[model samples]
Target: MEMNIIETINRFPDQSSCIAYLEGLRWQNEPECPYCKSKRSSKRHETYRHQCHGCNRSYSVLVGTIFESTKLPLTQWFLAISLILNAKKGLSARQLSRDLGVNRKTGWYLQMRIRKAMQEGEDVSLFKGIVEIDETYIGGKKANHSKKKRQARRDNKLQITGYQDKQPVIGLLERDGRIRLQVVDKAHGVTIKPIIEKTVSKDATIVTDGFGGYAGLSKIFREHQVLNKDKEQYARGKYHTNTIEGFWTLLKRGIYGQYHKISARYLQSYLDEFTFKYNHRDNRLIFDVLINKIAAVT
Candidate 1:
């Protein structure tokens, strides 16, 4: 079962409990040397570190994982992980800092480290079985809708072209299964088609709104379903893109509501976080699922 905030705190009340949890999950028998991958190791006296006989080195369960080099206590790290995983709309770094009694900088670093583990590989398996594809533009909150901000941006010569001001993000969701999200330079066929081809399988049927970018998809995939909203024909049979659109609503609420502002440089990482949570929303052990993911990440 997923661990709630209180349960998470109770489970790892101290640093030693957190270390023991990691040790049990990372190794079944004796602790293995991360450097040499050998099980020949002994616990250091009065310390969590272990001595490896194979490489003549010392290590801990935190070695090479997301917790590596972190100065924060293991209990706090575990609590942060639990908080992040439990936040459906996402918990901001400032809020985390306030919650954990840490400064904003440390909270930001902690979040960024955890987010790094959420990244998805580009070569992950294709999405089959009725896929829904869509694109949306994300950016700051209308430049705060303030004339002063707008004037400042204009004085600095910032982009004012409505959609151009925002970053284009494409989402391809496999109906009731997994979803893939990517930030792209354009919503045109040139940039989007390649992503569709690589991320989606040829056998899967594709559904999308009436976007010119997806015009060529009919030829590449086995079947393409389009809902020409221009004619107000939405859901002609099962061709609607409602599923992915609903997902967009959630993502936008999280980014625009929870985060408020996200730099384009790190936009994809934010996408990865949303994707991870969405993909595992159904799992009863979602907290444990994220923990396992953290265990595998370096």
Candidate 2:
């Protein structure tokens, strides 16, 4: 069955249900005191506080968590997370505020906190088999420009400018499999090559455009197929960068439509969020993963 906001509400309707669920996820067996790590804990039998028999102190489940010291209802927080997970393209703070019936400032803070919970990244092993790598730029358009000039600006924005002044993103995708993306400082050989080596298995075949930076990768990989886009030859046999290029389309749409304008400093966090969601696209456990993120941060 699909896990929806209603299911979350049904599963955790109140503060007590929220506490029980969080305690279950945080502590598999006996509940320990968060302050002293004592196993001698007793339920306050009052509100959402837990009492430690050893330390003689009371604590709520929200202590030291992302939800700590928050006055909003847990139902609202769960609804916010649900909205974030359900919206494939992402939602603006104003949209969230309207949907949740909350103030715009509260909605903004809620979204930022949810993004913090979404900032979980684990060690992903290198991509094996055929890997495609590419890059793209992200920014908004300005007004007062003619239609032809706007089109030209859009065209110029597609080129993968090195990571200096703008956000230079690098995408590596295993053919018919998972993908990895990162914001980099530059696209030069020194910067891109090590990333390729670290993220791709040594024996995997690599494909890219005829960028001189990718010159020496063939010595390490089984094959380094460079489809020179300048020469107008996009593919030869099974060599192409369509997978990684496809990621750029979704990313650009999300940035332009959802975020509007992303600061260069915080671009990678959004990139991580997109990568996490996309990597787990096929898994029905995405909500579970998001919950785990909350458990970690909280």
Candidate 3:
């Protein structure tokens, strides 16, 4: 069945139904023992247990998968994955906990596990052609009590520092293709250069805003085009960081509107979820893709 939250609940009403779904996706009829990778197995008992004849070991289909040691019902996990994947912006742990009837920490943990599957490393594939690169900050305002406190102050107060209490995130997006995002410690030539070198192809033309951090990018790539936002110049011909900036809008809306706030610790996971969704925007089998990715994590 096509998996929505309702469909997940209705289709997988029990643990066995959920297990069947997992087995269908992972094993495809031939159940294998995860410990020994032996296909000789039988459905001997409950919890989808399989007796491996080759290894003489008993294991469930969930073994080594994300649902291996789960205390919650597999139904809930399927629903959560469905909800998280379908949400265009993102889903909050708090809201997810309420929906799943679990504790906030459990909901957060569930999200982290799914995000791990969605994660794409720098080695996935290189961006080619006119790739747009940009750096943005993620965080709330700083506190007024003390300069060191880092607490967000009043909304109307004049800002002393431009990027106080914020984390720097760099993005490299291929024109009408995939995007790679990273949470960097800083946005400077030394920090940004290495990332660009690894993620983008040297033959591709790079487009970005006139940020000092991108100082030496021209020397590395075939061409580095700059859009001076400071001078009211944004795009000319095929030269603009608009595509990436447009992606930033979806990301920011997801962060600010859906999540409201995110910590530096788990920010990368949020980025992973967003990047995965954005990259596969046109994929009709997105739900299945997410499920496959989750299975691959094993």
User: Highest lDDT, which number?
Assistant: 1
Instruction: Report backbone clashes per prediction.
Output: 0, 1, 2
What lDDT would candidate 1 get against the real structure?
Answer: 0.86
- Rank order (by TM-score, best first): 1, 3, 2
Instruction: Encode model 1's per-residue lDDT on 1-298: one tens digit a residue.
Output: 3578899888889998888777777785458888989898889999999999999999988888899888899888888888898899999999999999999999998888888877766757889989999999998657465798788778999866678568999999998899989999878889999999998999999999888999988888999998888898879776678899899999999998889989989899889889988888888787776666677633
lDDT of each: 0.86, 0.78, 0.84
User: How well is each residue in 1-298 modelled by candidate 3, as lDDT tens digits?
Assistant: 2357777678889998877777788888678788888898778854468898988998887777778788998888888988888888899999999999999999999999889888876557788999999999988755433644433344445555879668999999999999999999888888888988999999999998889988888888999998899999999798888888888888998999988888899899899998998888888778778877666534
Best-to-worst order by lDDT is 1, 3, 2
TM-score of each: 0.92, 0.84, 0.89
Q: Evaluate model 1: give its TM-score.
A: 0.92
Q: Specify the poorest-scoring 10-residue window by lDDT in model 1.
A: 289-298
Better of 2 and 3 by TM-score: 3
Report the alpha-carbon TM-score of model 3 versus the true structure.
0.89
Better of 1 and 3 by lDDT: 1
Q: How much is the lDDT of residue 268 in candidate 2?
A: 80
lDDT of 2 at 231: 78
RMSD of each: 2.3, 4.9, 3.6
- Name the regions of candidate 3 deviating beyond 4 angstroms: 1-3, 143-160
